[model samples]
Target: MYFEKIDSLNDLKKLSIEQLKILADEMREVLLLKLSSHGGHIGPNLGTVELIIAMHYVFNSPIDQFVFDVSHQSYVHKMLTGRKQSFLEARHYDDVSGFTNPDESEHDLFCIGHTSTSISLACGLMKARDLRQEKNNIVAVIGDGSLSGGEAYEGMNNVVEVGTNMIVIVNDNEMSIAENHGGIYQNLKLLRDSKGKAECNFFEALGFEYFYIENGHDMNELVTTLKKVKDVEHPVVVHVHTIKGKGFKFAEENKEMYHAGPPFDRKSGKYIYPLDNPESYPAVTAAFLMEQIKKNPKVAVLNSGTPGGFGMNAEWRKEAGSQYIDVGIAEEHAVAMASGMAKNGVVPVLNVYSTFLQRAYDQLSQDLCINENPAVILVYLASVYGMNDKTHVGIFDIVMLGNMPNIVYLAPTCVEEHFAMLKWAMTQREHPVAIRVPAKEFISSGKEDTTDYNKLNKFAVTRHGRDVAIIALGDFYTIGRDVADKLKAECNMDVTLINPKFISGLDTALLDSLKKDHKLVVTLEDGVLEGGFGQKIASYYGTSDMKVKNYGIKNSFPDRYNVEELLIENGITVEKIAEDMEKIIG
Candidate 1:
């Protein structure tokens, strides 16, 4: 097998165009074998196989640095760079992460997960190379889907300043996680249709020499085109039109579902893993929003190009029609547009993943929060249950968004409470509301939540006891209840359990009342303790007699972590916290 023969770039360069084509076939076989048993990014990697092979064949990598945009498409690059065993063998599935990691190999320039920052990051590398008086080609391989973000424009704008050898390869597959959105796609279409001879070109407008390849799958064409721009003195963009799901039939037909999903059957190309819970948060949220849109015309659902994360399926998005907006991968634009919609007497619910919403901090603060626009922002996967990648951790929303002025951040513990909070936020017109949805499927309270959220900063005390009070935030409420129960069972202690629904505010009255009976107040949050919910409570009781103990993850980037093990290591478990409590309050 050519793939077995490919030990390094030197081995790759020894192969002819015909041999490289055979190598491409072998690489796809490895990709399919690994992904069929252990699923990962199917479409992106398949599409970029020939492109990456051509890149390795032309450029001297590790010297001629290549930065992938999101690195979801970097699987091919990884395979070519002495890590083919990871893809070829099922046992080595855990050897590498889904995204590019510098720790895994020196060939990977950066550990990137977020999109549209490639050109900008490559600029930094080029600048550093210039400083060191070294001459090497710095290339950024970005997908067409990532072009929707404003950062790509900013990056392209700066690339003109770097008058050196830098290549930006635009892999146009006409698909994002969802289908492409925004006007840039139209311009890209114009460029593609004209076949490199288009007037009013975006790349040319950015002051870079633009080259186009109609068939990006053609290995000969890719190699020839790349060699032309290899030693170019100035910045240039190589726009190549390729298929997203190139090799696999299932991936080619259903690009969205195959973008990234669970393990599948090799022969039939059917998914082997099934959704265990149909009543998941995404499913529930999709159902709720679809029903809401039918009742009110002004009620619009907006997502920052991540419909799957928010549970807005194809059917739901279709039914909503113009009421639904997929603002591409532009969170800042989505947030700002939601604010404008809210200002015009329309209730806009902007749903975004917690990590992606970090991009819109300025818009949330200056545009939405400051104006008191009464828009509902649903921050999904904003807990320890979210993705463990350093770039995409959802645990820092409390640190980033909680302290923002005039924004009401609500944490719902159960499904019923989440619905109640959503209902209230939909109708409320006085202030902007952000609901940090529970990460896991939560058990219902069995009782209707009739509490008025307008009277904000109210803490709901589930059980009353003595000595120690445990205040839980969001999904951690269940953990607090378990700790309280464990304390009772093991230590013969009846500790109080309080679910703090409002993360943006503290219940000062209830906190003051706790001082009378409670000697120690323990705060639990599903986030970092440093700039999060627990630290706010610690700051509140700084001068008080009640000793405050905060239990949560530390301020650091933890990649590919097991949730249960992370909790134990952070002293966030019921047993660990209970043991600490016994030592102090016994």
Candidate 2:
């Protein structure tokens, strides 16, 4: 087998064009096997097999630097670069991360996981190479979906300024995580239709020599074109059009669903572990938004690009109609647009993931918070239970957004509280509001939340006791409750359990009240300890007589960690917390 004969790029270089074609098919089989069992980016990786093969054949990696945007499609690159065992053998599946890691191999230049960063990163490499007078090609592989980002344009605009050797390969599979959006895609479509003869070329306008390949899957064409651009002096863009899920019939038919998913059946493409919960946060939020859209024409829901992640699927998007606006993979624009919409008497709810939301910090502070536009931002996956990838970790949002002024960052423990806070945010006109949607399982109190969210920074005293008070934020409330119960059962101590609804501001009255009876105040938050909710509490009581113990993840970028193990490492387990409290109380 061509694949069996290959161990590294050197081995791959020995194969003939006809043999390389056979190798591509072999690689797809392995990819399907690994992805079906292990789970990862299926379609993105599969579509780029031929392109990555051609790239490796044409450009000498490690010598010729390569940067992959969003790195999810780097699975094949990893396999080619002395890391095939991670995919070939199930026993070694957990050895490598899903995204590109510089530590894993020399071929991967950066540990990139986010979108629209390749061109900018490549520009840095190109600039440094020119400074050193080095004669090696610097290539950036960016997908067409990433063009919607502001940074991509900024990179394109700047890459030409250097006027040096830099190659940008645009993998146009006509998709992001979902289908493509924004105005840039129109140009891409035009270029494709006109067979690269389109007069109004976006890349050409950006001062780059542009080349388009109609069939990116053609290995001979890819190699031939890539050879021409190799070591060329000046910026160049190689636009290649290929099918997203090339080898898989089901994946090609359902591109969005197959972009990235859990383990599925190889033949039928049925998910091995399908989502069983209909009342998930995404579903619940989608239902609530639909109701709001139908009731009020002014109510609009906005997401950057990942509609499925927010539960705004095809059906929901169709139902919401124009009220649902996807700004593509542009989080910064989404925030600013929401602010403008809110200022013009339109109620805009911008739903985004916590990791992606951090990209729009400036817009959140300046456009929304500074103006106090009353724009509602629903932040999903903002807990330890969220994304585990270091680049996509959700633990930093509390610290990032919580510290911002004129923004009420609310954390809800259950569905009831979430709905109440969301409804209040939609109607309120006093300040910009952001709600951290719980990343844990759906919890229902079986009662309506009648608490007036307008009276901001109010702490809900769920269970009252003495000596020890546990103040929990968002998804960690359940853990705090368990700690309290453990203290009660094991140590026979009645511990007070408090749920702080507001993350940004403290309930001063309640804190003062707790100081009177509680000797030790423990803050539980599903985020990093530094600059987070726990630190805020600790800071608040720094000059006071009250003893504060903060529990959260330490400031570190942990990748693909087990949730339970990570919590245990951070001293967040019920037993560990209870044991510590017992000693303090004694």
What TM-score would every model get versus the actual structure? 0.98, 0.99
Clashing pairs in 2: none
Candidate 1's C-alpha runs over 4 A off are 275-277
lDDT per prediction? 0.90, 0.92
How many steric overlaps are in each model, in order?
0, 0
Cα lDDT tens digits, model 2, 1-586, are 7887788789988889988899999999999999999888999999999999999998999899999999999998998999989989999999999999988888888888889999999999999999999999999999999999999999999999999999999999999988788899999999999999999999999899999999999999999999999989999999999999899998999999899989999878798987435789888898889998999999999999999988888888999999999999999999999999999999999999999998999999999899999999999999889999888999999998899999999999999999999999999999999999999999999999999988988899999999999999999999999998887887788888999999999998999998889999999999999999988888888888898889999999989999999999999999899888878767
Instruction: Evaluate residue 280 in candidate 1 and report its C-alpha lDDT on the 0 to 100 scale.
Output: 74
What tens digits encode model 1's per-residue C-alpha lDDT throughout 249-288?
9899988888988899867878887643567777787789
Query: What does each candidate score in C-alpha RMSD?
Result: 1.3, 0.9
What lDDT would candidate 1 get against the real structure? 0.90
Worst 10 residues of 1 by lDDT: 273-282
Name the weakest run of 10 consecutive residues (lDDT summed) in model 2. Answer: 269-278
